[model samples]
Target: MSVKGIQPIVSEYHLLWEALQHYQERLEKFSSMSTDEDQQLKYDEKLQDMDGLLRSIKLAAKNDYQLDLK
Candidate 1:
């Protein structure tokens, strides 16, 4: 299937992408290290936040701009 025309190069898109990358790297680092009970809870929360952020970014790209970023 063919792709659409030009997609808007918006700052929000780039910012979201960068933020995702940042979170992903942090998550990887956290995964590699050991955590105590309290730290584990915080890490889990952060992972959830990252998941939500990713979903929001994907939804925003599709709904707000009609761009299927995936």
Candidate 2:
């Protein structure tokens, strides 16, 4: 593909990386906080959201283009 065609994919990858980093930071912060049931649930949901994001990325890589996530 031409450079122009690849630009959007690169931009999307960067955005996804940023979002994953934000979620990682939040999960780390949550780890040090109180383990109340509600908080735990929220933390679990956040983890699921992260997993969903990852799955989407993998799916895109499989169906759309080759992505070296590792």
Candidate 3:
């Protein structure tokens, strides 16, 4: 019962999957809140950040690169 021969890219994919889940939870909570204009702007920014991260993750999966998070 040993885990071996795992590649870096696969490890990164797992990390990104966890991060995506965390962000999605945050996004859902934010969406449920009633916020002022400034707060709404902040939420928008957060959503954008999540979107960008998701896009990068997709690209990394497409290219099979673990370092693409840079």
Q: Against the true structure, whose TM-score is highest?
A: 1
Q: How close to the true structure is residue 14 of candidate 3, measured as C-alpha lDDT?
A: 68
Per-candidate total of colliding backbone pairs: 0, 0, 0
- TM-scores, all models, native as reference: 0.64, 0.60, 0.61
- Candidate 3: tens digits of C-alpha lDDT, residues 16-57: 667786887787677658467677677778887887767766
In candidate 1, stretches whose alpha carbon ends up further than 4 angstroms from where it belongs are 1-9
Clashing residue pairs in candidate 2 are none
lDDT of each: 0.66, 0.65, 0.65
> Root-mean-square deviation of each candidate, in angstroms?
7.3, 5.5, 8.0
Ten residues in a row with the worst lDDT in model 1?
Answer: 1-10
Mind giving the per-residue lDDT tens digits that candidate 2 earns over 3-64? Answer: 33443375676577677868867886885584797887788788778877777665564445
Ranking according to lDDT, highest score first? 1, 2, 3
lDDT for 64 in candidate 1 is 57
- Candidate 1 local lDDT, 1-70, one digit each (tens): 0135334355667676677868877876785584676776677788888778777677667765666654
Better of 1 and 2 by TM-score: 1
Query: Between candidates 1 and 2, which one is better according to lDDT?
Result: 1
